[model samples]
Target: MRFLLVEDNAELGDAVVAWLSMEGHAVDHALTLAEAHDWLAVAEYDLMLLDVMLPDGDGRSFLRETRTAERLPVIVLTARSQVADRVDTLDLGADDYLTKPFDFAELEARCRAVLRRRGTPAPVVIPLGSALFDPSSGTLTQDGESQRLRNRELRLLEVFARNKGQILSKSHLLDRLFSQDAEVTENAIEVYVGRLRRRLQQAGVQIETVRGVGYRMTAP
Candidate 1:
């Protein structure tokens, strides 16, 4: 999953980004509404973590305007713990609200809940031939055995499994796989794809390279 985290606090923003990224989700952190707008203009994000008090403007107003423009799922992260504030934000179309100084684990749960409610929720476990791939934990199970995959490999597997049989361009895969790393090259993706292909081959899955265009995944 890809997330656009809109917050201004350096400490909090850094912590959230690190936490989400470690969980195998691609995250782009925007420190202000202007930066958020720029990110929104360029990339399609699965969720937005918006801070109510930004350096540039009120996040509530931004949420209102954003609702009019797109169907992006937003979870407001704010210090305002008032019941009225929560109700008002919900009325404005926020999918969820998290007050400041909250638990990171809780935030992660809320994010998953909001995504499941707002978007096409992925299966809890996707069957790939003889294996079962769990998106939530990035684990692949086969023959009643399961093992958690490395972060990048898990992300690549999830992306491929979600869009099975569709040809994904290198540029598109690059954006999804290496959103936070500007230094990663297309060659890096090839390495990851090669590794994932080897793993999936045992499960009766194939990752096909489309010559000059991109790659496609098919499961038997």
Candidate 2:
């Protein structure tokens, strides 16, 4: 999923970005509220990891201003862990809250939980034509036979299923599958698409490519 991280401290921001990237999330880092607003204006993000303190303005004010229209899930990260602070952020429509010096694993888990809560509950077996994709086990089955997919393949399929019928560009797919540090080329995306297409075809599932644009996975 795409995440916007709003933080002011350079060192802390870099560390959080690196950690989230390693966890296979597409993260955009913003050091100030102005920068965060700029990103929110142009891009779509699944969640916002907001730091309450900023150089020019407080993140709480920013949340209050954009909360109505954006309606995007937000997780407030702040050093002020007082009860009042928590109450204030929650009142401002934050979906979750995390204190500073938090564990990265816990943060990742919270992000996943928030996103899951925002999305429809995935079925145990997703049926597409004669094939069934098992979300729980990340396995694809056809005619009672099952095939295990690599982590990246499973993730790609999950993204496709989650946003079924949407044309996702190659760059967006790469951002979803690999971290910023992972070396990815246009050809790399093509290679993975080829492999995924062959596997799905073997299972009698159809994934359509929008020539020169991207790909879409249709539901049965």
Candidate 1: misplaced stretches above 4 Å?
A: none
lDDT of 2 by residue, 164-207 (tens): 77999988888776644456787777887787788888655667
Candidate 1 lDDT tens digits, 23-114: 87788989999999999999998899999999999999999999999999999998998999999999999999999998999998999899
Clashing pairs in 1: none
- The segments of candidate 2 whose C-alpha lies over 4 angstroms from its true place after superposition are 119-124, 129-131, 136-152, 163-186, 218-220
Residue 77 deviation, candidate 1, in Å? 0.4
- lDDT for model 2, please: 0.81
Steric clashes per prediction: 0, 0
Best candidate, TM-score:
1
Query: What are the root-mean-square deviations of the candidates from the true structure over C-alphas?
Result: 1.4, 3.3
